[model samples]
Target: MRKLTIVAIAMMMIVLTACSEGNKNGQGAANDNGKAAAQGQDAKAGEAGSDAKQEPVTLKVLRAGITVTETEFNAYLADAIKEKYPHITLEWVEAPEDVEIEPLITQGTVPDIIIASTTAATSDYERLDLVEDLTPYIEKYGVDLNRLKPVVLDTIKTYSPEGKLSVLPLSLNLPVLFYNKEIFDKFGVSYPKDDQSTWDEVIELGKQVTKQDGGVDFIGFDVNGPRNISTGLDLNILDPATGKSTLTSNPGWLKVFNVLKKSYEVPNYIGADGRYQYANDDDIFFNEQNLGMLAFNLAHLIGPLEELRQQGIELDWDFAPFPNFTENLGTNRSANVHALLVTKTSKHKDEAFQVIANVLSDEVQEKLARTGRIPTIQNEELEKLYGADIPVLQGKKIENIFKTEPRKVIKPHEFESDVRKFVDGAAKRIALEGIDVNTAIREAEDNVNKELQTLQTTR
Candidate 1:
């Protein structure tokens, strides 16, 4: 009986041991299954992440008239774009002189982006319905429009009928009074105050410097054109409400004509044959080096001046704030913005806006400012950095360019370009033909009215 009981006990112990081994094996199998399931999930997640990566896209950028060369575009914008978004490729489409935007659209090749002047934005783009409102994209991207100068924003808004933010100003052209130091020194006339001179004061100073020296004629002052002088007065050529020329009624037009007429009336300014010898262009100031002072576009002159310096042709030159009308003291020329816009037909608007935002980034803006293009943003430090990269602009009083605030821009009429001819003619008749301001204004008004009527009939 004792032997049978021991045998039962041994059998029970063996059964218990087998049960313990089976439980351990089952737990190990469960753990292995859990690990395999986790690994499968991780692999699927990796595939999903790969699929979610952005596809590469090529965005075509049209250069309408902003003077951005391919090399400059690559250096200033394209490379930065690549670093930020490896997916986007910027293709620069340079519009030939004769190539119109309408033809490009009909060819099914509308560009994703356009770089153009503010004037072009108001006229060409508006006429063709090519601009896309960037307000929504600006919100989506958190683009800080507040960083830009208020005048620039105001000018851009004025161009739009509904005040939609269609374009972002990249840079602006501010007029500066460029003077030949040699001419001032020759006449023993004091240099024009950097930011304190008025148009009347400048004209009187021009009288001091206007003389024949060394058998060469030195004109006291000349403007690039009537347009340059008119900008400071915020003169609009046509009244938008009536679609008629404002030359006859706007008192500012009379001031503009008088200023030019006074400058040309300086002694020996008109040639012996009863013709105005000094042309209303930069050639007199830059090449001939005879004109004492020239009110011209600062942004447009930087490249040429830099090139001249590089070629070892240096001029004894300096610049002052653009002379203001006595009544409009402390008012600079109206903002002339060069803007970047996303086209209405663009499929990659988000990406295009990202590009614009990147360009307006502080780093890019600083770099561009160093190259002498005025930044649209209102950073004093950035403004101080102007012309830091150009050897010619070193030690120049570049600060004068920003002394006066830009005037609030008036929206130009569609006929503004057409009307400019009559205004120019009036100025020519007054300066060269010795016509009276009242008579010149009347002639300009009559001619512009006739032209507007013709344009209205044709359209």
Candidate 2:
């Protein structure tokens, strides 16, 4: 009986050992399966992250001036945008001469981005309430405002009373004194001191070169307009607070008008018919090669001049610093920056700002500078790249554009553009009708007050 009992105990021990081995094997299989599942999930997650991309978007861009073309957009800006975003496609909308912005707003086709002059930011966009404050986007996108030129930033801020930054400057339109070397040489007069002459000195030089030769009248000097002259003196046509014309009260306007008179009164500058002979549209200095000195916006002339050169129309021309006012020597003309603004109505505000930020990137700004657009960024190297692409600018006084610092910006009044016509008329009277500066200013003030009254009533 004892032997039988021992055999039974041994059988029970064998059964228990088999059950323990089976449990160990089952736990190993469960752990391997769990690890395999976790690995599979990690692999799937890695694939998703690799394939992720920004959603495709199309942004409408409106270019305000006549200078911006579709081809130039493609060449300078569009490719840079494509390379960075890849998902973004830009649609260029040119502003037509006859068509206005209000109609586009009514049609719900307002552009996502607006590229316009700083003047238009205050006069047109602000008046229409088309722009939005970009401060939030500027902060959210990590944009360093310190990267931009201080004058450019200050000019943009002046447009907004609340100090909202509504625009990002793309390039500058700083004034430059462009001269026809052929005109100076033909008259046997020395060239105006490069970037070192004040307005008074330049005017004196202009008088020396103003003469009749070969039955052609060579005018000594001319400006783009009286508005440009007034701008340099930091003269605003209307007071922002009073909404009244400053033409009569501000002594600066007197200086501005007198400068205009002196510039035109160069002996024999006016035609026999008593008309200002040089129309800017004909580019008298470049095409006619008769004007000795011209104070004009550098950006406006450089590209066109280069194109003329490419067409084999040669004029031995060079530029100097924009001649300064006697009281404001070494001071540049008022800040004139071409800027980009995101519209208030844009649905894709973030993306629009992203595009603008990209446009202001170092790579893009350098490329723009190489193509002859003055960068708004404060980089010495980028400034050196100005006009690098335009072969005609080689060895020319390209640095003269940056030699003078921009004057403090005078915030523009809404009636500034309307009032400019009266000031221009005043300048004409002084030059043509022999009116004194006070009389011209008084006449301009009277006309401007009446026009402002009419504008207020109509609005």
Candidate 3:
């Protein structure tokens, strides 16, 4: 595995070098607006209702990450596409990671479509121009963008240039508060409500439940942080206007940290050795039955619980909307969605888009949602039907998945990664090393600026 990873990285370097050359040749920096405008004109000629000749073509599909497999794709979406366009054939190619496809793109052998994690599609790929702007295709096809959840669409747009949605999301992970109902019931504490819960109120509730009861050590709340919580807080770690670090200056960030500080400071929440009182998060929540609540994604509601049941343990759990900051109430956390993008180099742009449109249709969305893959669609009626195909989630409060609106993300730079690391480290300092929150934030701010300066100088 190590050797394969090394080879993958080495291959990626060569591919990137080749792609850099291709980009310099002018094909890579093609203006997205031009494409959107041209596609819009073409779309006018070829509306979905129009009797346009459907061409026979084969589309090469590249699945970049483990988010979806060819087996699953073939089962869920392949035949549906055929039913819509019998002449268009999909050639599916799955890569262990996205970088493996860079070689093909560099060789002028681009796949018609690329499906990947938002992280891989947006940041990991350096050549944004190679990914086609889907705005025109969407307009031409008359694909209803609003049918998808607003937050998911907003996140996809963040990856585009000039606010053009170059990629269309398929599945999304919405952050929410997952709680073990049995634990709440055992403590006689009221469950967190969707619309009314605030961070301060939730923390107070967590304190009341964080206790040793009947020989079981119950933790009021546990979450994997600070990235997860920071995202939920909708805290802008960077100044979007200037694309600079706001580690110390963002007042909202301090409030977020304050809430997290209170969480870790709950008596007996963390052991003296800087670990949870129980063995681990899964064990603490699933087996020991002690964790009262966890802030997590919708996907966790399906896979992890199923795994525990297979191990002869079952958790009586439900989820609520992620608690909001008092000031940021009603604002949703950004959806980290897995989206599909059309490659600019594809000869079958129209056909590629047809496939995408078909996938995002209400019918397909419902089918995907039933598999515990949350659909990007905004239909509230669909909420009642989520996890319908998954037997384990039959009676679960899947409605919590859509509790909050999706938060919009600011444009991010590579330096934002450094800022996240610095702040996350500061969080550790506050929780484990007993540093003052303000002092830690200030130190983190200085350290991040220095790091950014070093990065700039080196560049």
Candidate 4:
């Protein structure tokens, strides 16, 4: 009996020893795996350090007018760029108001990045060989060209040779119709639909509201400024092909003039003195509250309307797609497209590209779009969130604002600034001075040609 008990105890001790060995083996395997993972992480960290040691660079960014700068870069963007490229510093430089950029080009001190409105001014930059073609960098950085608005992107590409991308669009300003709901209610006229209303329809609506009630003059429809009226007319004052004035050459010009002419002729639309009797064009929409409808870009209307609304000054206003000329229906006028261009003189072209890429990134675009700066990218998710940050657009009809695409003016004529002034002059003569359309167009053509000739000589 004693021998049997002793045999059982010995068997139990052997089993316990085997279990202890198994646990130690399992722990050894786990320690080996942990060491391998730590070594792999160290290798990755070393690779990242090697990449960072290449070089530190500071890019000079110059902007003309109210283009993007440090002031508008926002805190989120600044931190984002810093986190991505800690070695890169962006130096903001502004060209003096009186000094032309041509001198900078002549001095061989062109900035690494150029931000400006892609207009005739940018065309001049292209002519001077200052603007760099970014097709290669676009590919290098894997920029999703498909993400941008096709029409506006195409317009910017047209500014480059062989359809190369010259500028990265920062924002697009499309014309829109802003109307005072109070004026519509006061005049007993139904509000124009943002999506469906046409210029002709707006004209008819204007006739109803443009009348003196209790000796107070009310203008039915007026453009935000002379440029707004001219752009809505859709007349390309300069012909890119011929470099001549199209004010008289194109029949469309005559029709464009007539559209504005008919609007001004709406009974009591203008005062006997040929000026907005109650207020300037913008004030008429906000403070005076007498303007039934206003044709302007989002920039001109949204900010001011929001300011008024925040001040507790009630302005019953809503925006719609811009009214179009009968011939130019389904087309919205896009002007003052803000863009960023890399200069050929940039030493760190790759780093400069990253800056622009960051600009159009989802994070930055959402920020800009929320602040009422229209984004260049076409994002459906962002669309639903448009003006979400602005209190004034809380219940307004803003969907139509993005419904229509601006007509692509692929070949914008040169000397456009001069041509714009000439056309505006013609519009003034026809609408305010009662000058004949034919006579006004002919005079504008001759004046524009003379100005172009002088410009050619100076260049």
Candidate 5:
């Protein structure tokens, strides 16, 4: 792999996990907004919908998001948005995670406005001509562009074909390699630390540390890779600039396999059920203590920690940047692309635009930071929204992740998550099942490519 590839992986940011409806690429921190909302008072700079409305009118909107089991800040934000503009009755048309949302769009059962990363499957939906290009309306409304972080602005640009943003990105997590301090201390091995490292070193560390403590088998490390193996592909299998999977072709893949598959017979870590299953990436790492080193979405960590905390179970850990594939590939990242798409069907397009404007504001971003979310509207002035004097902007700086870069769309129906699943399954096979590294990669590549090809044929 090129040096840029290493840097990308080492610096890869797992941007989400939370009260989030779907796809938190990073780990979870604290919710600054939840803290604010708990106060039950509106923000001083809350949605300024009245100013934009020429007169009172109900602005109907269609939404595309998961019907979360627990709606934290999301439910509150919905209420706040409605309160900000009483004329705008924001209809949140959420769907189940496993169900396909395209059919609703086809049948005109979709909401007027949509909010979810799933909409990024615009290419698939575009074939159906479902999403409306809101470029002219956006320019006419003159939304507060200055409020957004420049890197986030660029991410929006990636979705837009002609310098027009497609969705309003809200929260993101900067992925980092988290270590269990207690586990490392007990094993008497110093924990890995650096902005980056090579996969070789990570394996060496894992090999030395895999052991049993009080009858519980502990893995030296674990990663929520594509197929469940620790192949570094979970970090960044495809280049953002080029929409191609680089598993079998990259040197990093080899190293990822060698280290993650530390044990040919067993997975690096056990699961919540005590089995080495490759379900929810961060859950196994946090629940079992089966893993010592974990590369996961930052937000994913928070909920597990919260549950453990509630049960009075103590959790110990800290984080570092992902290891570099090669020193020259100075930065590495696992990318998570989240976007907010304006529904052409929205009656209150103008008011919805205003709510989106606030979503990208530093005031709201500060809340994201406290919750351990890297904000889309980061700036020097952005402070933590959870406390009067807390700072949240620093979280973005920690992982070298500044923006939500748009990744090239692989060929599977955009809605298909098979690519992620393929990587997860393939990585685990190579690591635990003693599969030939090259062969495993080829199989995964083939599988992903096949899925992509199938999408094209369907189209």
Candidate 6:
């Protein structure tokens, strides 16, 4: 997560099988970042003697899903890479939409790289050793590790090791506070300042405005997503000392979750049309004019703000952070980080490491910053491009969402599978059968621990 010199990065591109990418809207900008890269540092493209007179080599890459920039951006980046290094070619490996890409990775049939999403899914690839570790490559190429924000780098470390540096996050997700300003002003309540309000306060505010609107009602949050649910819990449960899970038994967490589940009673649960609701988070903030507050990631907030602006919605609204946990002040959950890693099993380790390092250079970062990605390189360029201000894409990184508890890579399916069953059964017995909350939680934890033990000890 540091910046490399333009020269070093170009050399890196020559050997790296794939470029680690994060939060790409489409393909062309992905490569456009390369243009700024070329300008930032003029260096050897790593065209060795034999390949000097020949064209640069072409490297094929695979992505987990189709990108918004797949058609235009991918081609542009490919062309940019080729132009930067005369002898290089860029080939793509696009799988069918329904295809499971990880199997190909395990079988060693995957492209030079994988642009994936979600830690749960990406960790699966790392555990399978399907991706390469890029740490050595970074050190070898003199990447400015200091430039990258410490927290972003820390997230990657939670799942892997410095020795392995298997995966690198290119962008990060910060969950922002979403408050309906019109509602706040209408009720003579002040909007949450920097998201300093507690969940209890938010719920109380929602309750006051939870009145019927021609039979349609409103509530506090719409966190129907399991991941969102997990993130809220992830932060509240975070143990700052070691970043372990300390929230399972915390009453603060229980109260928060209870409030979340209670929203279902107010027609604000956001069950079926979840994605649309997320996209319209700002619109809901403006339109409802009564719903107090909510929290979600950048895309969830900014995307909807733009949507509402275009539609001429004139309600007041803004984004901020979730209230800080006393023990983990300034800490929040960071999601969707992308990392560049060199495969331990690679035949061209030197070339791969160099190439991965090249992509992290300031030249490339400047271009990527335009596409809304936070650069790993800590340089004036990022500040100039992304701004010193944490533009409420979500709550400004309070303490630091990136600084989290170091968690070892748990097996991909283990926790979620058992968690799903335990949560379902527990919720059913409690919500339906009227079991106690603490008892249900204790049962769920036991079920999850059993699943974890099996996964760890199995093979």
Q: Give the range of the ten consecutive residues with the poorest summed lDDT in model 5.
A: 4-13
Candidate 3 residue 354 Cα shift, in angstroms, is: 1.9
Candidate with the greatest lDDT versus the true structure: 1
lDDT of 2 at 53: 59
lDDT of 1 at 305: 61
Ranking by TM-score: 2, 1, 4, 3, 5, 6
RMSD of each: 23.0, 23.1, 10.7, 19.0, 9.6, 9.2
Error of 5 at 331 (Å): 2.7
> What's model 3's overall lDDT?
0.67
Could you tell me how far off, in angstroms, the CA of residue 310 lies in candidate 4 after the best superposition? 2.6
lDDT of 6 at 111: 61
Candidate 2 local lDDT, 341-369, one digit each (tens): 88999988877887776666655666566
What is model 3's C-alpha RMSD? Answer: 10.7
lDDT of 4 at 437: 80
**Model 5 off-target regions past 4 Å?**
1-76, 79-86, 91-94, 106-108, 118-121, 124-128, 144-147, 226-281, 328-330, 381-429, 442-455
**Model 4: per-residue lDDT, tens digit, 111-170?**
887777776335777887878788877765556666677876776776666657788887
lDDT of each: 0.73, 0.72, 0.67, 0.67, 0.51, 0.47
For candidate 3, lDDT tens digit of each residue in 41-128? 3455356636766667899888776346454466445656776678889988756653576677668877888888775676655355
**Poorly placed runs, candidate 2 (over 4 Å):** 1-53, 97-99, 161-163, 277-279
Number of backbone clashes in candidate 3: 1
Weakest 10 consecutive residues, lDDT, candidate 3? 1-10
**Residue 131 deviation, candidate 1, in Å?**
1.2
lDDT of 5 by residue, 336-372 (tens): 4455565666556666666665455433455455444
lDDT per residue for candidate 1 within 242-339, as digits (tens), equals 78778878888888888878877777777677656353554566677888887777754566566566568888888898888777788778878888
The 10 consecutive residues of candidate 1 with the worst lDDT sum are 1-10
